[model samples]
Target: MISQTLTLELKQVLGALLFGSRRPISVADMRRVLLEVAEQNGDVGGRFAQTSA
Candidate 1:
C-alpha cells in the first residue's frame, strides 16, 4: 500500500494536470502522466498493476 502523503501528493498532481488542461484528458494520457509522476518520485514499485478485469 502507498503512504497517505504519497496518495495526497498524487491527487494534487492529478488535480493540477486536470485543472490546467483546456481539453478533456483520456484515461491513457492520465495513466501515463501518473506513472511518470510516480516514477519521478521513486514510487514505481508494485504501485501499478495490470488486471484482466
Candidate 2:
C-alpha cells in the first residue's frame, strides 16, 4: 500500500509531467515514467500494479 505522503509526491510528479507536456499524455507513457521513477527510488513493490486500464 502507498503511504499518503508518497501518494502525494507521486501526484505532484505526475501533475508536473502533465503540466509540462506539449501533447496528450498516454497511460503507457505515464506508467513507463512512473515505473522508472519507482525503480530509481527503489520503491517499486507493485505500487503501480493497479494502474492498468
lDDT of 1 at 45: 24
Judge candidate 1 against the unseen true structure and give its global Cα lDDT, from 0 to 1: 0.60
Candidate 2 residue-wise lDDT, 5-53, digit = tens: 4443667768978999999999889888777666666654346534554
Question: Clash totals for all models, in order?
Answer: 0, 0
Tell me the tens digit of each residue's lDDT in model 1 across 27-47.
777777766665666654225
Off by over 4 Å in 1: 1-8, 44-53
Each prediction's TM-score versus the true structure? 0.56, 0.61
